[model samples]
Target: MSPDGLCAHRFRHTAITRLLRARVPLRSVQRYAGHSDPQTTLSYAQAFDADEAIADVEKLDY
Candidate 1:
């Protein structure tokens, strides 16, 4: 079950996002995600930016 509800697609999205955030190569993520097109894997990369931005901001201390 997903956080909100049971949805298999969410698992796919999360897995891809997590792999990207972990600095996994795009090709590896694509293969693991079973994506036929690199573009599909690239799309999941966007999900990681927000979290990365927050982490970067946290590193700054005023």
Candidate 2:
């Protein structure tokens, strides 16, 4: 039970993010997630950007 209550969408979001982070192909994730629009699945890419950006900054030699 989430503090915000049980919302199915939150689970969907978490699954999407996990799959993406695990390097699952976007098309495969779309099919697995049952999203009719590829664009909708692509939207999850933004969620990973912040983490990736942080990792990039950490890798800076300076």
Candidate 3:
């Protein structure tokens, strides 16, 4: 992909991720992102949730 395409993709990704992280409802973010499938929006939410979950788990004491 071209550099411009990559930048645009990152912008989309970041926007969706930030919205999900902000506790915006999934359906609202999906509509704002123009995602045809709810799963597409869920994927971004899952990725962010998984990353935070891993980080929190790592801080656990034995």
In order of appearance, the predictions have TM-scores of 0.63, 0.62, 0.62
Model 3 lowest lDDT segment of ten: 53-62
Q: Report the Cα lDDT for candidate 3.
A: 0.71
The per-prediction CA RMSD against the true structure, in angstroms, equals 9.8, 9.1, 8.9
Instruction: Report the lDDT tens digits of candidate 3 across residue range 1-62.
Output: 67556757778888998987887766678789998766667677665666654554354343
Backbone clashes, candidate 2:
0
Model 2, span 1-62: residue lDDT tens = 67869788888888997887887766678789898866677677775676653553354343
Tell me the deviation in Å of residue 19 in model 2.
0.2
- Please give the TM-score that candidate 2 achieves against the real structure: 0.62
Instruction: Single out the weakest 10-residue window by summed lDDT for candidate 2.
Output: 53-62
Per-residue error for 17 in candidate 1, Å, reads 0.2
Cα miss at 15, model 1 (Å)? 0.8
Query: Would you list the rank order by lDDT, best first?
Result: 1, 2, 3
- Give the C-alpha lDDT of model 2: 0.72
TM-score of 3: 0.62
Better of 1 and 2 by TM-score: 1
**Number of clashes in every candidate structure?**
0, 0, 0
